[model samples]
Target: MTNTQHEPRLFADEAAIRRVGEGLIARTLPREDWTHEAHLAACAWIVRMRPDIAPERDLPAIIAAYNEAVGGVNDDAQGYHETITQCFIRAVRLHLARAGQADLPTLVNGLLAAPEGQRDWPLGFYSRALLFSVAARRGWVEPDLAPLPTVMEA
Candidate 1:
């Protein structure tokens, strides 16, 4: 009925994907597939559910919460609360650490073949991002644009 944009997503316009990637660089320009809010919700659920094994199973609901939260109770973007992105990253890392894992990145790579050295976004962006998120929130992964602050003192 209505003209849809960014559809058949795998075939999404390269320009659009580039724009999304660039926008992901900074929080300034938002993408059609914003992950932050959903990431937060998922992270929060992880904190609550505290799965001892295979936490990934519960991830979808968390993403949904984030998506739902972002748009508002009714999905109005204004209804979303800006996640304290750093805190979210830190929390996930801490959770993983406390869960007795080696570290977020190593754990992630072990789980998903996500190379720690590459600058390229994952071939499976969302899956990789979700796992990497644990590292990001936990402070295992440090990026300049991140909202987190340094805690370890020299």
Candidate 2:
């Protein structure tokens, strides 16, 4: 796969993202996924930029391998997450702009970086969500925490 810096960005809404988070918690982290190449890449990036986050071994592959053994994987989790992050970042910036809270990116990054050795966390899905949430609370992105509306029978 080529670098994404040259590729166009992808974005998604809150519902799908929450669903992705759930997927991560259920399918990937606890069990694992087969197509973990993407996860592997993401992990490598985190490790490369912040060695403190790097595991002693290939964590993403291990997680993916584990989830794949579960015999079921949701194909859309990564797609949803990517979409949410891109859009969430934009949304947070816009929200801050309206409220006159500038320097949104720096604040959110700092929030994400608060915990030491956060990358060493065994669970990638949880870490990713944790990072996003901390960012949201810190104004790195908007809290789109939209829920899937409940249905009421008439």
Candidate 3:
């Protein structure tokens, strides 16, 4: 009989989480070569991280907003695209903004410190970084934390 006990996830460690977040941010620039799977993964991660945002509840409106902003091209795009992820990220931001929860660092930290089993920590880490990137671009949040040195810089 094969014992199927799962190994405990360690990405919840602050350092590990920071590393994952930094890695995602470092690689997710210039918007080059982002695959459909990656965009879907980001959306999935975001939903998992913030179930209260309820992608089902917000995705339609988000998509509509994205389509409107981009001149309705997104509706004709095939598969999971960067626009999809961008829309979802913006939707989450809008939801939080409506609730007056604009402290992104605090939100990210709280999600990181959540019980490991309750969330996909690695994906959550990536999603938080993605969210930060979007927020920073829109001037919605400031990047005020200690910078995580990337592999290229190290």
What's the TM-score of every candidate structure? 0.24, 0.23, 0.26
> By lDDT, is 1 or 3 better?
3
> On lDDT, who's better, 2 or 3?
3
**lDDT for each residue of candidate 3 in 5-91, tens digit (9 for 90 to 100):** 433233334343344333333443223323222333333444445455555455444434543443344322332233224433543
Deviation of model 1 at 111, angstroms = 12
Q: Total backbone clashes of model 2?
A: 8
Worst 10-residue lDDT window for candidate 3 reads 142-151
- What tens-digit string does per-residue lDDT give for candidate 2 at 50-147? 35533323333334444565664424432223333333223323333333442423333332232211232212223446444534322233223332
lDDT of 3: 0.36
After superposition, the stretches of candidate 3 with alpha carbons farther than 4 Å from their true spots are 1-35, 74-154
How would you order the candidates by lDDT, starting with the best?
Answer: 3, 1, 2
* lDDT by candidate, in order shown: 0.34, 0.32, 0.36
* Tens-digit lDDT track of model 1 for 1-154: 1122212223123343344333332333343565432243334334433455233343333333544544535132232222323334444444444445453333332212212112222212224454345343333333434333322310
Candidate 3: give the clashing pairs. Answer: none
Model 2: residue 70 alpha-carbon error in angstroms: 5.0
Please say which candidate is ahead in TM-score: 1 or 3. 3
